[model samples]
Target: MDMKKDYDLLRERAELLKVLGHPVRLCIVRGLLNEGEKNVGDMQECLEIPQSTVSQHLAILKSAGIIDNSRQKTENYYHISSPLAKELIEVLFK
Candidate 1:
């Protein structure tokens, strides 16, 4: 294994793990994987957290390229866009 050659990949994996390290964030991803796409309202309801808090976590997940959202009129529906994230969640649950 060449650390120098794979440094970028390692860094990206580290960042992903860091983003997922949060309990809320991990729960959010796991929910998406199990339930398919969801809006902020739906997530907030399920998480029992403030909508703002859910949005904040969503922003971090989005910025990290772990999730993506589609605007449907006024509501933005989010889904897991990263295959790595899905695999990680599956591994964790199993």
Candidate 2:
């Protein structure tokens, strides 16, 4: 096997898992999977966390390509983007 290529991919997966290691991020991912698409306001309400905190966690998930958002007028609705995250969410939460 190509060690470098495998290591690179594993490194990326590890980083994504690392980003998900936080409790808030874990709940946010699980929430998106369970609740479907939502905006920062919806996440804030459901997670019972500050808007800024939710946004920060959302940013991390977005950067890791675990979730994505769509703009509808003034609101940005986010949803799970990575199939791996989706699968992990289902397996871990279910």
Candidate 3:
């Protein structure tokens, strides 16, 4: 493989890992993998954390391309987007 391509891949992996390094973010990603897709309210209830806190983490994960979200009316539902995240969650949770 080309050096530039390898560097870009490594950078992306590092960025994803960095974003998931937080406990809240890890939990959110794991939850998303297991639950399919969920809105902030569902995550807040499951995590027992404030909605704002969950939303903040969700934003980071989404920005990293590790997660994706869709809007239904006013509710935003988030789910895992990266296969690496899903694989990691499976390994960690199982």
Candidate 4:
């Protein structure tokens, strides 16, 4: 691969990681990974966090493309977008 492409990919990955650096976002990611797909209410119940706070963190994760959402009826469900999240979380636990 070209060096330029590698550099660009690294930069993009760095930005994604930076966006996920917050504790709240990390928690949201972890919750999604563990629970498979979850709505804001599920995250709030599992994480014991306020709905607004969880939504805020989820917004960051969504903006960063680290997670994706789908609407089911009136609820939006969230899940990890990449396998990198699983790898990162495993490393964090090690």
The 0-to-1 C-alpha lDDT of every candidate, in the order given, reads: 0.98, 0.91, 0.89, 0.84
TM-score ranking, best first: 1, 2, 3, 4
Using lDDT as the measure, what is the rank order of every candidate, best first?
1, 2, 3, 4
TM-score of each: 0.95, 0.93, 0.87, 0.82
Q: Name the lDDT of candidate 4.
A: 0.84
> Taking the tens digit of each residue's C-alpha lDDT, what string does model 3 give over 8-77?
9999888877888899999888878877899999999999999999889888988888999889999988
Better of 3 and 4 by lDDT: 3
Give the runs in model 3 whose Cα sits over 4 Å from its true position. Answer: none
Q: 2 or 3: which has the higher lDDT?
A: 2
Model number with the top lDDT: 1
Off by over 4 Å in 1: none
Candidate 1 colliding pairs: none
* Per-residue lDDT of candidate 1, residues 1-94 (tens digit): 8888699898999999999999999999999999999999999999999999999999999999999999999999999999999999999999
Report the C-alpha displacement of residue 81, candidate 2, in angstroms: 0.7
Off by over 4 Å in 2: none
| Candidate 1 weakest lDDT stretch, 10 residues | 1-10
